[model samples]
Target: KIETIDVTPLNNEQSIQASLKAFAQFNRDPYQDPGTVMRHPGLLFLSEIGEVKQQVEHINALKDELVTRMHTLNARARNTHVKMAWRGVSALQLYRHITAVDYAPRKALFSWEGRTTSISRPHSKEEFIEIILKTKDMCPAHVSPLDWDDILRKEILYIQSVQENGDLVRMKPVAPHPRLLLYKTTDVKATDTIFSNVPTFVKTAPDCTIVELTSFDFSKTTTRRKKRVFIPIVERLNMYFRPFK
Candidate 1:
């Protein structure tokens, strides 16, 4: 890993600016992919005008390994699930993993460790297991429109969360379904085709930090063989990675 960066030095405007500045470091159209939206950090994000005030700690011990995995995606952005929280701070910390070309997902997760409080959005229970299970390789599953009942619930709760918690942190998902687009995607579900609570974090990643990891190719290959695991599919779309790892 290059090094653990303490980006806490940023506040609202600066944080927003940092996001855009970081965009300056990369050049790629994140939206060419059918579902992904071109980010407008310049317009969507606020400009920097403040100093650093709070800082959050790195909880993921394997942060370095995570960075290595990012080598595939180019400069991309995502919503994260993690938060650098304080006893009563209104603003939360967000982690935006980048892949020199695209953003990584799940690599950036949300974690809150403090009091035991919870938020909930009300909606009919969804057939979540069925819908989630339908994503099998090569095999397609059908979902009933009624099945979306709970998804809307989750989204409603997600929004309620942004209001109640006053902060958000999370990573974006790679799934192409519009229902799953929360990051830099133009297709925001029109008027609650599905409603969700405003998630605290961007589920998508702008870039990944894993490429900077020390070389361990033999180990990585072994890892793939042993676990039958592969890099995230989204990585293929990213162009920042070296032609060959």
Candidate 2:
């Protein structure tokens, strides 16, 4: 199973992510436990609405303090550009300003599938992966092949995608890139639905870099369809991979 979302640290939205992290934890028996999800699946800090409004003030202050506390960490990296690959829909490696994130607390209550699901986190990455595998692919009506052994053996890669408009997008920086995997999302997932619907490519072909995605949810509950629609993000994509010298 594959799922993706922008995970950034901003003091105010921690609760929202706490809710997601909770889902990440309760994902195993989400249908069974509504109470645990209410508490937290993992460690989560609590924040009041007024606290959210003051986040910007706190962040600016942290920046000033960091100027001295960690000035010796890695000065050389300031001028160096690191290269990473995006295996979902684009071969282009995004040039991002890498920096430390400031985390915030998760609010107590939120909505999921029209029902309120609380914030909690999985204790370990292994546990997180388990739920991601189960929740991202399976549905009340049908299930995709998220439990295949062959798929598990492949290296897990994270692809970030951005839709510029209706037709264009950018994908890349596939963290933990498979020694090879096409740019298509389905290819990484190795699922039959994406294989049957999306264009095909063997290994990590450049052609697979900028995939023309076709959504495959014509027959699921409205609540279910929504759950599946947002996933497997693409880092970046372009009609042309800018030639660099």
Candidate 3:
């Protein structure tokens, strides 16, 4: 069975102290990645602190390994469980794992040269919309109908596609938009969908942080061994993107 390791303790004691002391040199830059820490002089000095060089090196190496594993676990935890149908085929249950935290919003910047010069405000709708568009291009799904006329036309076309080609075409399944498209897909009885409460990003448009995570299951008998998919983070942000009640 897969298990989870409580990583909070990993950040609790002396290890965390070392990390902080090293990070202090960088003024605790919120955007610093693991590579940034390695290149920083203060962090490198931890290994040369008196006779702790060799031991510190070993600990650091282990920490790196632990961090990699933790990333995988975090990705799995953020995974979405849902049923996806392609071209009217039987819906395939999938565990969609959304990775790359760097894609998330940056922390509020509150200082500059020891003086607060700028502050983070809710990001603009255009930024979120851009992200959404890029995500849709990557996931590309059939255009969802907006009104009854559109729906009726799409339904009719869907039938014609099957009759003409003996398969679904034109009216096809598109990549999920997380916020809008997913609800319709899971509006079925076969799959149990769950959306967790987690802030993917903070939005300035509505002055509220968007907090919601979608989860899905993985199949052990699927024909595809491995697949990579991207989830549009803006779908959630759009929920709080202002102008909407």
Candidate 4:
């Protein structure tokens, strides 16, 4: 699991000190239990640490090292077919002790028909708490959102009772996975999203040729479809450009 990764192997002492220095500048006061903040439950401090101009150079250097380490890991694992698609700058996230987070299952974002579902979108901590509390009674006719939410909450609480610093968490693509973070101490970590492409296979009917099609869903309606010729594994399509160097 990514969470079990010992970042010590990937980062050097200089980079670690730089990250700690940046955190110190951002969080001047001594660590406090985020649970004490009645206004926000889990979050103590959240911001793009790169915005600190004084430490921007050091931060970027650290980020580059991390990205390079990812590529190194891929190569070491013989996953040369996989390539980094995109990555974002690291954001500093500080959580208080005893902090708990209930991440919505990835599948909840879509429906059984593979369409995006219209679920409650909470923008703030207060709003999120309200939504969770009200989910039990909201009881929409289509699905029971409460059952899964309750189960995930309990499971997270039970499984992840403690998380230390430098631990990384990876979320799988297009799967319904839940995570809970119960910080034993003031938690500080750099978070970023790295999208990667790996070799994949598409299964099709034995006798039928697979064709590619594009469609857009607007106002809950799919617009006109545009069909494209399917390129087989052995054949290369000229339509797409080569991956960037």
Best model per TM-score: 3
Residues 1-245 of candidate 4 have per-residue lDDT tens digits of: 11121112113465445444534332323453321121111111223322333344554566566556666664435233232232221112222112112221111111111122121221333333333444455545775677656744653343243222222111111211112222222234312111111101111113322121112223343323324222111111111111112
lDDT of 1 by residue, 1-245 (tens): 11121113344576566565543332224434432222221112112212111111132223445444443444232112112222221111111222221222323221111112121222211322222334333232474555555544454443343322121221122311111222333333321121111112222344511111122222222111222222221121110111111
Ranking by TM-score: 3, 4, 1, 2
Clashes of each: 58, 29, 7, 1
Q: Each model's TM-score, in the order given?
A: 0.17, 0.17, 0.19, 0.18
RMSD of each: 21.7, 22.3, 22.5, 25.2
List model 3 lDDT by residue over 92-153, tens digit each: 11111111111112222111111111112344434333434444333214554344345444
Q: In model 1, which runs have C-alpha deviations exceeding 4 angstroms?
A: 1-140, 161-163, 172-245
**Model 1 TM-score, 2 decimals:** 0.17
Rank candidates by lDDT, best first.
Answer: 4, 2, 3, 1
Task: Give the range where candidate 2 is weakest over 10 consecutive residues by summed lDDT.
Answer: 89-98
1 against 3, candidate with superior TM-score: 3
| Whole-model lDDT values for every prediction | 0.26, 0.27, 0.26, 0.27
Candidate 2: deviation at residue 144, Å? 43
Task: Give the per-residue lDDT of model 2 (tens digit) for 89-201.
Answer: 11111111111112321111111121111222212334333433554433334434554433432312221132222222122222111111122243335222211111111
